[model samples]
Target: MSTTSTQPANSRSRVITASLVGTTIEFYDFYAYATAAVLVFPVLFFPSSDPTASLLASFAVFGAAMVARPIGAVIFGHFGDKYGRKATLVASLLTMGIATFLIGCLPTINQIGFWAPALLLVLRLAQGFALGGEWSGAALVATENAPAGKRAWYGTFPQLGAPLGFIIANGLFLLINFAMPADDPSQKSDAFLEWGWRVPFWFSAVMVIVGLWVRLKLVESDAFKKAEAKGTIRKLPVLEAFRTYWWQMILGTFLMLATYVLFYLMTNFTLTFGTKPQTLPEGGDPATFVPGQGFAYTDFVIMQIIGVVFFGIFTMVAGPLADRFGRRKTLIWVTSAIVLFGLTFSFFLMPRENPVGEGTYWMTLAFLIIGFTLMGLTFGPMGALLPELFPTNVRYTGSAIAYNVSSILGAALAPIIALALLSTGGGNPWLVGIYLSAMAVLTLIAALLMRETKDSDYTGDAGEASASHPAP
Candidate 1:
């Protein structure tokens, strides 16, 4: 504690706070687009003669970001590993802000025709590129400052940004929905699709400004600084990460699979299902007499907020659990839970109505609780787990690429897959649930197969340090 007093502690706290807040903003910007893709993009950017095709089109563009994420990881990973986490963090945020703001300014399909979607894909790629570097930088800043024994616990703090970012992004969207008039059957939803949909995108500019201010306050990590002092940083970080840490990256990608699916199910698929009249439970009958009647969006928002809180709580719990029981045990249990919950969620909880029926409220609560709880377990330990798997010299690039690459496979396509399955399988949540459950099982198997790295030292030379750290 006394190694570097006054200035160092103050600077570290500033750095951690900035890292957390900046990533939170980045996630929010990225998530805002995700929410729009599920809720409004079909109408705003990809309207088609056929309604189903329009939804599919929106999802295609949504998939575009996921596909671009791996590319972003490679490009950003090179810079992050070669340079330093701080510079990459700043650059990623700046790029994300610009892309998001451009998304806001885009004219609808009506104005720009097919070019609307084409240009939307480009901006989405930019968003993916920026986000690829943000999380690794944030994680490094927080974990590098943590006390040795408490690294896992402190590491969980940066990961909290994911749920927190979702809270902000979805919370804002809910607020806008309440304030706006898109809900009324008598009113023109077109008005919102044309102009109001842009509000969230436009609001991204504030996040960029605030994010830059906070990020600039951060100092480089002690680990990275030391590596620089020794002149040991990798020139080709992406290649190094793949050559040495590919197994960890693959494991992380799989481990993250269930968590990402759960998130998209809650945030995107639920919104799509909830708003669709045909999917509503109880034959499209509005429960106007119910106590919480006429508060459809409100209920979903409340449930998700509760889920986010539990996400934080479980993340806090995961740290100690990982320390006591080990990362493998924790991840295995969490992945199993994801499978079990996915079954219950996809089978019993999904709303059967076109627009979500009132009965769907209970399902929403069930899914929220299950998803958020598992999310806490998996995501909480991952911050420590990923970095611990690699050496400090390539830690940033290695972990960032792994994490974002997983996001591409697990999260980026989740909504599209869910929607596609629904369209093809007559809205059978069972099938979607089954698919998610299988991925969770694979994750559990991956966890079981990995060697435990909980007792490894991360402060030494790459080879010796990693030998001690191992894989699990």
Candidate 2:
């Protein structure tokens, strides 16, 4: 097998399309559940006399999927490393699509009692399991097939799925909300709780079909083919990955920690905090009142959508910048900014004394834009950086483990921890900001400890010798 087959079996268009479409669908499925978790699940799946308890229960189920992600990573990573990227990518997409569609068809708590939440948990785990494998495979497909010196730029295609999926999922929900007949435009309609929330999940089936079509047409990248020809493919990549590259795995996990924490806080925690009423409800006890900006749900989501636009734009921009300046330098600067951004959470998110005033709304919007801009800068480089941390033989397993473990540490607990901190701080977001800043500081340390991977060899069997070496 000539390792010099410069012409790949997959066209550039196909490579980009397959990776972008598959992840877009997968993220769409995940974000659909995320939106519903805040809006509908607490009411429909986990009914409680205490609204706070119900919301917490809903978030707990949301986090349960993170526990399953590492398991998915191990299973899918094994097959991805041993077999090839194409089959594993397709399988992950199918599993996620099926799980998402089934969640749409599930009975609510009103109809099926505890079983509703139980079934929802089962499907949510399946989604997490599929996603564990989804991101790494998509990243590999883009980076492994990239032209020389452009891997980081190619890598951003998969990362682009995050903002695109968020936009589509939230846009669909916003449209559904607007179309529904709500007695109060600020509150959720009965129709939205009963059935409208399920539309995004079912719509995922159509997207899966499209993703499968593109991915099925994909051929193995030359990097993987060369690795196989050299007989470097391990029978058990996960064991080998842990045995040899354990430090890389640890570094990669913490490298991603701030990104995950910032992202979930931007999306999920913001939704909860933004929409909570500033004043107590009529006849409500003063003791239980939680202060918030009191923006209507529709209005707050629109603000989020605006911020996510910068996320998408900056994600594309980070790729070229990373390629030019090196991943380590780019991440160091961005992570430092994230640390600073975390300190200002109270300054931006604090509601004015008049919560409904225009000044409060604009301040919240500014906070979102800045946070999401940082999100894009940090997230874009990770596609190339994580996979670059391992040899081609175990790239899938190594990168997937790092990414998913961070999901547990960062994403799974971010919303729950933020909410707890919010309550602990008497509804002020200073504590939540401190939490984000603390996570960014950890990521910054990890970045400083890691070597630059901009020029790492992708086709070579030897991993980066200096990967564990501290940056000067």
Which candidate has the top score in TM-score? 2
* Alpha-carbon lDDT, every model: 0.73, 0.91
Q: Which stretches of candidate 2 lie over 4 Å from their true place?
A: 1-3, 282-288, 462-472
Mind sharing the TM-score for model 1?
A: 0.88
Q: Please provide, for model 2 over 1-472, each residue's C-alpha lDDT reduced to its tens digit, 9 standing for 90 to 100.
A: 3546655657899989998999999999999999999888988988876777888999999999999999999999999998999999999999999999999999998898889899999999999999999999999999988887888898999999999999999999999998895898657788888889889999999999999999999999888887777667777888888888999999999999999999999999999999988877776566656677788888999999999999998999999999999999999999999999999988887767888688988899999999999999999999999999999888999999999999999999999999989988898999999999999999999999999999987766533342333322
lDDT of candidate 1 over 66-97, digit per residue (tens): 77777777777778767877788888889989
In model 1, the Cα lDDT at residue 107 comes to 78
